[model samples]
Target: MEKWLVVLGIWAMCATCAVLFIRGATGGGSGKRTAAEKGVRPASRASAGDARAALND
Candidate 1:
């Protein structure tokens, strides 16, 4: 009846809101980090030294 229709409409609205919220929280796109841009390089001693110095401070 009419009551069931109302309940269905509310349910659909709530589902839509939940989907939008999840997408917003997760950044909604590819979340990959490139090698060069991913923090300090492994082979470079100078970069590692700088990181250690910063951490000590």
Candidate 2:
């Protein structure tokens, strides 16, 4: 009987999580910005020096 109570408690918690997950997956709240809207952009570069920082001697 005690074991069954624990199982039921776990199921209830999972169901609550599922409800919250579905709600979040659908709307995702109000305020959000697109990548392009941020304005600043970096040019693509292939040189290793561009990516790595040099230490001062």
Candidate 3:
């Protein structure tokens, strides 16, 4: 009985991990904020560097 309980706990943990992995694969929990949502233009690497340069002026 004790051994069975241990196996069940491990199985549950693995199943939970698999479900979380699948959800992430399907974009279920992405917390990324879009530029529109933040009311900003999409920034590229060059634009970011320009912004920093401007700030240093």
Candidate 4:
């Protein structure tokens, strides 16, 4: 009975860890703001035609 209790405790701990990890990885309920989501564009962004023009010169 003691050994079974220990096994059950370990299993419960592992399940809790898995649930927390999955929640964190999926960003569950975390109101994080990304650059794109905030409508902020990077200065270095260029189109393919601009890159080609620069390379040909």
Q: Is candidate 3 or candidate 4 better by TM-score?
A: 4
Q: Candidate 2, 47: how far from true, in Å? A: 32
Output the worst ten-in-a-row residue range by lDDT, candidate 2.
48-57
Which lDDT tens digits does candidate 2 get at residues 1-57? Answer: 999999999999999999999998976533432422463233332233533422210
- Per-residue lDDT tens digits for candidate 1, residues 1-57, read 999999999999999999999989986445333533565444544556877745643
State residue 6's C-alpha deviation in candidate 2, in Å.
Answer: 0.3
The superposed Cα distance between candidate 2 and the true structure at residue 2, in angstroms, equals 0.8
TM-score for each prediction?
0.51, 0.47, 0.50, 0.52
What's the ranking of the predictions by TM-score, best on top? Answer: 4, 1, 3, 2
Q: Would you list the C-alpha lDDT of every candidate in the order shown?
A: 0.68, 0.58, 0.67, 0.67
Model 4 alpha-carbon drift over 4 Å, by segment = 33-57
Model 1 ranges off by over 4 Å: 31-57
Clash pairs, candidate 2, are: none
Best by TM-score: 4
The whole-model C-alpha lDDT of candidate 3 against the native structure comes to: 0.67
lDDT of 1 at 28: 47
Give per-residue CA lDDT, model 3, range 1-57, as digits (tens).
999999999999999999999987886423444533564544543466767745633
In order of lDDT, best first, we have 1, 4, 3, 2
How close to the true structure is residue 44 of candidate 3, measured as C-alpha lDDT?
A: 46
